[model samples]
Target: MGPLDRIEELIAYVEAAKAVPMSRACRVDRGELIAMLEELQAELPADIRRSEVMLAERDKIISAGEKEAERIIAEGEGEHARLVSQHEITVSAEHEASRIIGEAREEAQRLRDEVDEYVDTTLANFEQFLQRAVSGVERGRDKMHALREIGTFNPPEQEESEEKPLPQF
Candidate 1:
């Protein structure tokens, strides 16, 4: 039995025993005292067994609930970790795309600078060629004037080089 019930049982036994004492103070019949003790002994074991069953049932329910709670907690933690991993992969992809775009832009700028340099060099070379052409025309004019003054200016009709005829000044 529980502690309180054990105490009560003990007290009852003490009372019955005291009553049965063939003493002057608390006199009681012997047969009645024997009956009381016998009844108490029989009832105590049943009471103790009932209390043990109740405790066992309570413990079983508590342990089952605890196992269910642990399963739910483990599932929630797994879901959280999966979401975090997916987010990290997404962020990494975005970072890589940004880096590649930046590199492409830098390469485009480098090519543009090279094109600008080439164009400037070509224009300078074309300008020098035009100046040389004008100088050659002036020299040809001076040669034609001297030949006319001497009355001895006769050019061969055909030239070996495949070129347009120089203008006679």
Candidate 2:
């Protein structure tokens, strides 16, 4: 029989026992009660051992779950750190690229200004040289006209003493 049934039987036995007159004491067979107690004791250890085993299994499962939770939290933290680092690197790279582009534009503008200055200086010098050449040509033309008007422009005649004879081939 189960422990509960044995306990009920013990309760019945005590209730049917003889009561002493005017006292809270009762008379029962000691040998029979001892035998019943021995049976209960024999049944108790197997049930207690099963309960202990179940409690141990529950503790093991709880420990494993806690360990898994810790691992997942650590992995999440590592991923967060890596993403933050990548974002910082991207932001730094963007700023550096902007700085480089700004410097390149400034340098390009400076070069353009230098080229324009050189071109303007060269054109001015060429204009001055052309003006001087035209002025010299005009002066020569004026001298020729003056000589013609003064009748001093003459065609030279070759004298016989100064002429050279042609060579016969």
Candidate 3:
């Protein structure tokens, strides 16, 4: 299950557990609780890794777009130079070169604009996803903290089970 789901499940488990007599703590199956916690721990790192991969991909895409834009601009400049040199050094030839250069610049600008728009849109969507993911994690964290502060569970008085150390982040 997802991190949010795991958090909700944990909350539900806590809510459904029996409350200890004369105490705020509930009696949850230690093994089950530990399992749920392990699941949650596993899920969180995957989400973080996914976000990191996406950010890296976003950077690569933006870089590629920029390189493509520069290459187009350079090609345009080269074409302009070639056209100018091929014709006799006349006013019309210079004018044609100027026109070519202008068109090249306009085309390059248009391409850059397109790339920018695409990158912005993509990044915006990714940002929204990341925001939602972060918010969900934060909410889960708050809930966990609240549960901890309240001391969610206490062992039964009659039966003492060996407590195992939980894995640390």
Q: Which residue ranges in model 3 land beyond 4 Å of their true spot?
A: 86-169
Candidate 1, 130: how far from true, in Å?
Answer: 99
Query: Which candidate leads in TM-score?
Result: 3
Task: List the candidates' TM-scores in order.
Answer: 0.36, 0.41, 0.57
Which candidate model has the greater TM-score, 1 or 2?
2
Residue-level error in angstroms, candidate 3, position 35? 1.2
Error of 1 at 38 (Å): 1.2
Question: What lDDT does each candidate get?
Answer: 0.49, 0.57, 0.67
Task: Please identify model 1 stretches exceeding 4 Å from their true place.
Answer: 1-23, 88-169
- Write candidate 3's Cα lDDT for 22-59 as tens digits: 76656667678778878877876776676567667656
State model 3's lDDT: 0.67
The TM-score between candidate 3 and the true structure equals 0.57
**Given candidate 2, what's the lDDT at residue 25?**
46
For model 2 the local lDDT of residue 121 reads 69
- Writing each residue's lDDT as its tens digit, candidate 1 over 7-84 gives 344344444433312332233343654454455456546655654565565556555555554554555455445545
Number of the top lDDT candidate: 3
Report the lDDT tens digits of candidate 2 across residue range 50-162: 55565565556555555655555455455445555686576555555455555545554555565556555655665564455445445434533443444443448766696
The residue-level lDDT of candidate 2 at 1 comes to 84
Of 2 and 3, the candidate ahead on lDDT is: 3
Give model 1's TM-score versus the native structure.
0.36
Candidate 2 overall Cα lDDT vs. reference?
0.57
lDDT of 1 at 8: 48
